[model samples]
Target chain A: MNSFQLLNGLTFAALLFVVASGFTLVFGLLRIVNLSHGALYLLGGYIGYSTATMTGSFGLGMLAAMLGVAAVGLVLDQGLLRFVRGQELRQVLLSLGVALVLNDVALVIWGGDSFTVPTPELLFGAVPVLDTFYPKYRLFVLGMGVLVFVLLWLLLNHTRLGALIRAGVDDPEMVEASGVNIRRVFVLTFLLGCALAGLGGVMGGAFLALYPSADAEILVFSLAVVVIGGRGSLVGAAIGAVMVGLLNTMGQVWFPELAYFVIFGPMAALLAFRPLGLLGRAV
Target chain B: MLQVEDIQAYYGEAHIVQGASLTVNAGEVVALLGRNGMGKTTLIRAIMGMAPPQLRSGRVRWQGQDLVGLKPHEIAARRIAIVPQGRRLFPSLTVVEHLTMVKSARATEGWTVERVFGLFPRLAERKGHRGNQLSGGERQMLAIGRALMLDPELILMDEPSEGLAPAMVQRVEEIVLDLKRTGLAILMVEQNLYSALTTADRIYVLETGRMVMETTGAAANADEAPLRRHLGI
Candidate 1:
């Protein structure tokens, strides 16, 4: 309704897009629901928190989170999920178990208390916007989101790897039969998706504190974004994130009692009309 | 050169390709002809190590090396490519993207994107069109062009003329002949009996997952009776 709410919606949507884009990609190419994505978020947040605290460099924390979380994702995919590659139900259950286990692991490491990444000194103030001032950090987050979108667009459009990913999304078997090492592509995609989730985790942790249940909350929001957007579409994920982010922020302000309903209502309506989602193809 | 020695592939428990065997010598176009559900496609997929029907027994050899346990891409890396049934073009990829997606790490002397474009001029004209947007004939051309991008020593084509017009079928035959002149081996599975007879140097008839007959294309074309009896056509 107001500028602050709009900014809040857009910034939150930016973070949601970062997380859900990765989620949707993994679903798109690797065909995994990857429920542990939230746990990866929480773990990355905790790792980033520690790194920032120890080294006093927010940049290091971001780098550490992305690399660390991607390593975990590599282990998850190559070690556990590879055995049950085509079994969707098994992957779901396995990733769910991993999520629960990682959630507890974070609990043991960071305890039940909430933690936040301190805003860097360079971004420690507010900037003036239309009719009001907004945190420079949030604006930076929005810029990062735009940068990611642009970079991904370029990668998918201009680069050979991007073409492979897009083609793999359409028909992976056909891509492989054309002499591409599709398994290598799958691993690269999973790593990139996990790394993005980690980056989103650090960014989200800075703005919204990270705690035990935060992982579940972020995971649910990401799942909503992916479902509304379509399983494997990048543009769909961005649009879906913005829609959900705006609705969520506006609903909490206008009608707190009906906030969840306000979000799910439109999503349910969209699903009833477009069962394959806005850009999804038949799986 | 490729050889399939007594491969038994199954879809879960349903045995689809039961003890089928065939071979394609270098520079030869071998056709596997059969009725619907006679496991022609299954044999092709089995050779490629695709699942369901899963390969339970036998060996697929390329250049004298066994390929039974290799991944589909690994098998493809051995200079073999598949133009699958239905074209299986990436519905989202444009014509040029399809050709470029095949990374040219192997023999650089073979087909390039430019060469493929030259080969299929229709594909060159509609270079920006997505796979789903192409006409059936154009889709077939693009599929063949995509396979050629790998510069494959051998190609596995499944029903290359399944739904083409008569003129398009003639175009496909010309392409097969053209590739053969370049010394490329091809293992084609086809439901269209006449199409196979035209492009194939040798033909094998499959009956209920078994190789019931093997004859030269010339012999089969000369006496269509035994081929017709085996094919039940």
Candidate 2:
């Protein structure tokens, strides 16, 4: 309806891209729908909040949250997920339990408090754009999202690890047969995805405010992002995030009562028709 | 050098590989001949530990070390690799990326990426092409080149000539012989009987997942009767 609303939509989309990319990457490589990703995201937010409060440095909080959650991802992958392997039902149940346990434990530690991470003083004010003022912190969120996109592109395309990831993504058995330690690849990819989700949590926590049920809330956004984007394509995630993010903001602006209804409509339609999303090969 | 003895593998309840045995000595090429659905592919899967046809009982030994129950990567690290059925090229990856994605696990000098390029100049010419962009012959060349990149002591080639043209099949046969000259052992499963007869040092026939006949390549090449009898070509 307005310029500010459109900017709000774009910023929201940027954050969604950062959050859902990890979920998509995990699905792409491991063929697992990690239900605990949302818990990990929430845990990162709390960790980022606590660490920033103690150190008075927001950057340190971001780093600690990423590393901390990545370690949990490794443990989850090695300790439990590895055992289940292709049993999709078992994987879902195990990850769901982990999510519930982590969220409950987080409630105990953080005590359901709602707070937002303080953007640095340099990014603490508003900037005028298109005859309107937008939060500088929101702009930073958009910038961080773009920065992540560029970094992921370089990592997936320009590096040796990226080649292995892509090759494994295409034909994992062949990669293993070609003499790669595929387990190492799996672990590394899991860690990368975890770190990304954690980074997204830090940003999301700052923007949306850290609070209880934030995990569940973001989980809904993430699942919708990936499903509408197609299961695991990075470009698909980016487009889907933008699509969902804009759709959410627009729905809230024009149709308040039917916001969520509109938000998930595209995903349902895609599943009924083109289940692979855009840019995805057939199942 | 490799020895696969009495390997009984299964795909769930279906007994796909029922007690098959074969061997490939050092610097030798052993052609495994069988009709379609005779468990030739499953035997290769069992050897590589892909495990759809789970190796229920088998003794696959290489240089006196047991290969049974080893993971695919472990088997590969011990200097064995597979070309795989259908080429199995990573469609999104470029030809050069396909070869460079894998490195030799053993601390030995075998085949390097450049060496592979020298062996298959066609691949070198199309090194920048994506796997899916390559022609069937090119896919086979890239697949073999990828297997060579692991610097394997023994390579398992499954249907490298399955869909190739006659000229390409001849090229593949020459490549196998060339690999043997460089002291790399090969176990090639081929439907093209002529390619196998020309390239292999020894030949073994499998029927219904069982090894039924064994003979030298020279003998098989000299006489079409055994080839005609076993394969009914």
Candidate 3:
């Protein structure tokens, strides 16, 4: 692939990583699918769009979106998933119901019209990366993605709280027996994951235009990224996103008819060979 | 340091521990002797606040505080640790990681990782091995080490020597005696009457979830009739 294409692919992969990382985190720790994660992302974008329109500041919009979706996530955790523990089918149905409700809610507020946040003037221009120019906003998204990845890595690996999280992931009963409140950990993890999704939604809206149906399409891609990356590993999610992103962009470029198969084909093969995605521990 | 006063525990509607009363003084090793199905493990579970064994009535007071409504972690945070039946080690974690994960929030001069390793050198040798990789003896040692990491005031050991070799059982006995010397209270539930009598300061014979007999160490060793009758030894 050309350098321009490569940079574009990397930028796309970075966005995917941002969204899928949270999906995987919630799935890994809580064993919750959180099908409404896409709705949360879409809600974040709408909140950001409205806030930015009102205040004329993208940064403030992002902050508002983060806080708004974090509250939504906490509500989902406490009101919904906490009561429906271990019932995967029920969670799926309920989350799908949440997605429908959120879509209707967005339609009532933002309507069916497409919308976009004007890229900040500071990040409006393109920067020459290799042989061609790359969007500065895309570069910012990539940079932010890496920064969050690093921060999350440090948080999950270096801190005492991180040790408890890891312990919970490995065996939650043992974690509870170890004198850490596993419920608090669950709530905190859910909020953190949702906040990431919300941030991704806002940034992604800028990258790709936002519409009501955007949640459904993005949810599919996010699920694909998570499955390909393995369920619980953050590093796996990032790597899987890059691999899928490259295949996605390149498949459309190189093989249009075979594009859809590219993502699932490799995943199926990987599962057949390793079962656990690359960098994922066996459950 | 621990008092279980006529505590009635149940699994669903089936009463498991029917008004079982027992006590373990500070620095004492008390054995709750019973057969496999006689609610020994159930009573321990009720005391630990684990589910399935619902505390129907009576009280489990530790240093005069009621333990009925507390969660398992809250109970553990109060300095009560359990080397549970089946040595419930996290199978993915190494012995060292298992111990390190549960390191006490409140530091105590009595027990440290170093001291635990010193007590069970076999555990130190197998520190890097995952829970599933270790033999039964090694797993039991790791379980004890994991509990000791909490620096617990009272440890409930359920079948510590359940599936160990004779030598490993002897080593475990030594560890228990050493722990008693350091003034930590222990409540052990064991079917091995001889081993229980050898280490325990006092013994409570449980028959069908009720305490049938209580005796001192000397009396327990001297008399095997109760054990022979109840446990069919």
Candidate 4:
């Protein structure tokens, strides 16, 4: 592929990584599929658009979106999800219901029109990349992805909370028996994951305009990323995101008619070969 | 101190721990001995507020606090810890991470990572190893060390010698004796009568979920016939 296609792939993968990282972590820790993740993304985008418009600050818009979605996630978990915590099928159905409700909410609030978050003046221009110039905002998104990956890596590797999350993933009962409030851990992780979803929404909004059904579309891509990467694995998500993102870009460029098949056909083959995913362990 | 009175636990429809009562005083080592499938592990799980032998009726009073309705973490915060059956180590986490993950309940100085290392030097050697990578003996040491890191006043250990070699079981006995010297109360469940006889100050024999016999470990060690008869071994 050409440099432009490559950059498109990398930047797109970066967005997928941000969205799917939280997706994987939540699944790893909570065992909740969180079908509303796409809804969260769309909601975050619209919230960002409004906030940025009202306050006239891109940064503030991003902040509002994250916090708002986090609050919503908290309510969803404590109010609804907790009732069916260990019932996997029920949680999935509940989240699907929530997602549908959220999609309607977005349509009611933001309507069916597509709108991009107005690019900040600072990031409006393009800069030199490997072989050509690229949009500075996309590059900024790339930087954000790298920063998030690094921060999450450090958090998981060097911090106590990270250890608890990893341990909880393995054996939550033992972690609790060791005297750590695993519920609090769950809440914190949920918030972090949701906030990232919000962040991804805003970032994706600015990169590609927000509209109806966007939630489902993003959700599908993220699901593909997680399934291919391995449920609940950070490095796996990163690799899967890149693979999906590049394939997506290549498909759109070369054979727009077969883009959907291009993205999912390989996933089907991979799943048939490795049902646990590339890096997933048996839960 | 821990007091368990009339704790009736069940697994679905199966009544596992039927009206079991026992106690472990502060600075004491108490072992519950039973044959396989006799509800020893279930009783421990009930005390820790774990599910799948849901506590139907029970009172596990630890440090004067009734443990009913408390989540497992809350019980842990009440200065209690558990070395669960099969080690139950986080397969992906390193040994040091396991020790460090515990948020000690007590404000005062207690078990630190360094002290745990000092107590189990082999754990120190395997500090960087993940839970799955450790040998059986090392996993047991790490499990015990992980419990101690909680700075708990009491520990509930389930099947500490279940899968260990005899040499490792001997090592576990030494560690239990060492822990007893630290004045930390322990409630241990074991099928290994010899290990229990060596380390426990007090022994309770469970027969089909009931406490059939209670005697000092010294007495039991002196006269294994009574304990063995109750255990049917």
By TM-score, how accurate is candidate 3? 0.88
Model 2 chain A poorest ten-residue lDDT run: A274-283
Give lDDT per model, in order: 0.90, 0.86, 0.85, 0.90
Candidate 1 structure quality by residue, lDDT tens digits, A238-257: 99899999999989999999
Best by DockQ: 1
Candidate 3 interface RMSD, angstroms, 1 decimal: 2.1
What does candidate 2's lDDT look like per residue over B1-233, in tens digits?
68899999998899988899888888889999989889999998888878787887889888998888888989998989899889988987888888778863232366777788888888889988999999999998888888888778889999888888889888888888888898989998989888888888899999999998999989988887977798877
Model 4 interface CAPRI class:
medium
Tens digits of lDDT, candidate 3, A1-283: 7877787778788888888999998888888888898999999999988888888898988888888999999888788787788788888888899889988999999999999976678998898887888889989988988988899888876566666676677778767877778889888988988998888888888888799889987787788888878887888889888988888878777888998787778878888877767766665
Cα lDDT tens digits, model 4, A1-283, are 8998899999999999999999999998899999999999999999999999988899998999999999999999999999998999999999999999999988999899998997789999999988899999999999988999999999988888899998888888888888888899999999999999999999999988899998899999999999999988999999999999999999999999999888899999999999978999985
lDDT of 4 at A55: 87
What ordering of candidates by lDDT runs from best to worst? 4, 1, 2, 3
Q: What TM-scores do the predictions have?
A: 0.97, 0.97, 0.88, 0.97
Query: Per-residue lDDT for A1-283 in model 2, tens only?
Result: 7889988998999988988899888888888888888899989888888888889888998998999999999889888898999788898899899999988999999898898876678888899989899999899888988998899989888777888988888988888887888889888988988888888888888889988888888889988998888776888899999999999998999999999988888678877887677767753
Q: What fraction of the native alpha-carbon contacts across the interface, defined at 8 angstroms, is recovered by model 4? A: 0.94
lDDT (tens digit, per residue) of candidate 1 on B83-189? 99999998878888888888543335668877887888888899998989999999999988888887788899999998999998998999999999999999999
Candidate 3 residue-wise lDDT at A258: 91
Q: Could you give the TM-score of chain B for each candidate, in order?
A: 0.96, 0.94, 0.95, 0.96
Candidate 3 local lDDT, B1-233, one digit each (tens):
79999989889999889999999999999999888789999999888888878887999999999998799899999999999988878765667777777774344566677787887788888878878899988888888888887779899999998989999899889989988998999999998887898899999888898998888888767887766787778
Would you list the clashing residue pairs of candidate 4?
A: none
